[model samples]
Target: MVGAGIGGLCAAAGLQRAGVEVVVLERADEVRSGGSGLSVFSNGIRALDALGVGDAFRAVTTRTEGLRAGQRRPSGAWLSTLPADAVAELRVIDRADLHGLLSDAVTAGTVRTGRRVTSMYPNGLVESVGSGTAGARRAWDRFDLVIGADGLRSAVRTGWPEDPGVAYSGYATWRGITAAPVELRGEAGETWGVECRFGIAPLADGRVYWFGVRTAGIDEPGDPALLRELFGSWHRPIPELIDATDPAAMQYLPIEELSGDLPTFARGRAVLLGDAAHAMTPDLGQGGGMAMEDAATLVGLIAPFAGTECGDAPELLDEALRRYDELRRPRPQRVAARSRMIGRLAHAPGPLLCAARDLVVRATPAAALGRQAAWVHEWLLTR
Candidate 1:
C-alpha cells in the first residue's frame, strides 16, 4: 500500500483482520499532526466498526444532535429546514484525532514514513526514495498488490493522463477549530446566502468547528480579518466563532473534484481508492466517509482468500481488483454529481435564485429530507 491517509490506514486495518501482511509506505515523515475536523455519518461509523475502531472513534468524538440544518439569508432569516433523522449516526471529529486512532489500530512496523513512491511497475514492483530523501536514493520492492489511497492529485491516478484531471468547483473554503469552547446557536447546521455559505458545529472537546464557503477564484485572498469581513455581519455567534479561532490554525483551499469519468480505478495489480479515485466536494461531508466504505468493501471483496495464501498467483489478485472496481466505482460518481448540484443550489448566484432555492427547500417535507439522504446514509456492508 502507498500513502497512509485515512483510506490507506483503515484499509490496512481491514486487511490485517483478513490475515494479510501489508506494508504501508507514506511520503510524510510522520502521521499528520494537524488538520480540521470531519463529519462522519452512520455509514462511515459502520466502516469504522468493520475496521474495529468505531469504539475508539466514539471515545474521541461527539454525536451531533438532530441533523437539523437549513439555509439562511444574509438577513438571518431561515430559508429552508433540513429535517434529519438517524441523529445517532452523525458525528463531528477532529481530523487529527481520527488519524491518530486509525494509525494506532494498525500493527507496529507496518507503516514506513518518509518514503516517497517514485513509480509503480506493471508486475507490482514499486520504487521509492530512501527515508529523508525525496528521490535522490532509490530502492525497489515488489508486492502482490499495490493500493493507492493518495489524495486528489494522486501519483497512481496521474499515470492515466487521458482521464480528465481534477475539476475545480469554482469555490473556495475556509475551515478552523476554536481554540476554546464557545457558546453556539443551533444544534448544528449551515446558513446560506447569495454566493456564500457558513456552517457551524460543536466538537466533543467543547471547542466549536466551523467552515465558510464562497464562489471565488482559487487564489482569492485568505486572511482571518477578511473572513471576518465576509461573514461578520451574516449572523450571531458566527462572528464570535471567527474571533475565537487561532489565526495560524485556519485552513483555506480551493474546492476541486475528480472527473467522474475515470477510465478505470484498477490498473494491472494497482488500484485507486478515496480521493484518489473519486474526489468530491465537501457538500455532503462524505469524502472521508466514503473512503472508509472503500476500505471495508475492498477487504470484504477479497474475503475468499482470508485464511489462505494466494500470493503465488497474481491472477487471483487481478480478478479481485476487477471486482473491486465493478462494485465501487458507480455509487461514488453518482454521489459526486449530487454533491456538486447541492453546492450550486446552496451557493446560488443571485437573490432571485437564492429565494427560489429557499422556497423549494422549505417546501420539502422533513421526512422527505431524511429519505433523500437515506440512500447515502443507509448503506451497510453485507459480508
Candidate 2:
C-alpha cells in the first residue's frame, strides 16, 4: 500500500486480515491528527463490518438519526423542512478518530511513516526515499501486487503515465468543527440559498461539524471574514456554530473530480484504489465511504490468491482488479455526477429556480429518496 491515509490504512487492514503480507508507506511524518468530520452512512458501515472494524468505529462515532433540509427565510426563519428518514441511518465522526481506529486495527510495524514513494514501475516495483536518506535517494521494493491507495495527488498514478489529471469543479468548500453548546441539540441539517449551502452534523461528544460551500469563481484566496459575512445571517444556530469555530481550524478545499475514462485499474501488478482512482466531490459525503468500499472489495477479490503458488498469483490478481473496477466504477460515477448536479441545483441563483427547487423539495416524497439511497447502502459482499 502506498500512502497511509485513510484509504491506504483501510486497504492495509483488509489485505492483512486476508493473510496478505502488506506494508504501507506514508509520506507524512504521522497520521494527520486534525481534519474535518465525516458522515459515515450505513453503506460505509456495512463495508467496515465486512472488514471487522464496524463496531470499533461505532464506539467512537455518533450514529446520526437522519438529515433535515430547510431554507433560510429572509425573516431569520427556516422554511421547507425535510427529513433524511428516506436515506439509511448515518453517523458523523471526526476524521482523526476514524484514522486512529483504522491505524489501531492494523498490526504494529505494518505501516512506515515519512517514507514517500517517489515512483513505481509497471511490474510492482516501487522506489521511495529511504529513512534518513537525503536529497531523494532511490530504493527499490517489489511486491506480487501493488495497491495504490494513495490520495488525490498520487505519485503512483503519475508513475503509471496512464492516469489523467484531476479536473476542478466550479466550487470550493470550507469545513470545520466547533464545540456545540450543551444546550443546542439535533441531527444533521443543511441550509440552502442562492449559490451557497451549509451543512452541519453533530458528533457524539457535542462537537458540530459544519461545511460551507460556494461556486468557485476564480483564483481568489479564501477569506473567512467574507464567509462569515455571507453566511452569518442564515437560520438559528448556524451563526452560533460558525462563531464557535476557531479560525485556524477551518480547512479550505477546492473541489475537483476525476474526468478520465480509464479502462483498466491495473498496469501489470499495480492497481489503484480510493482517491487515487476516483476523487469526487464531497457534496454527497461519499468520498471516504467509497474509498472504504474499495478497500473492502479489493480484499475480497484478492484473498483467494494470498497463499497460491507464485506463477498463478499474477493472473489471479489481474482478474481480481478487473472485477474490482467493474463493480466500483458505475456506482461512484453515478454518485459523482449526482453530487455535482445536486450542488448545482442548490446553488442556482434565480429566485424562480430557487422557488422551484423548494417546491420540489417540499413535494418529493421522502420514501423516494430512501429508495435511491437503499441501492447504495444495501450492497451485499460477495464471496
Q: For model 1, what is the C-alpha lDDT against the true structure?
A: 0.82
Tens-digit lDDT string for candidate 2 (172-244): 8888889554224453467777767888777789888888888776476777776777688776677877888
Error of 1 at 157 (Å): 0.9
Best by TM-score: 1
lDDT of 1 by residue, 305-332 (tens): 7656556555667778888888888878
Off by over 4 Å in 2: 66-84, 130-135, 180-184, 350-352
lDDT of each: 0.82, 0.77
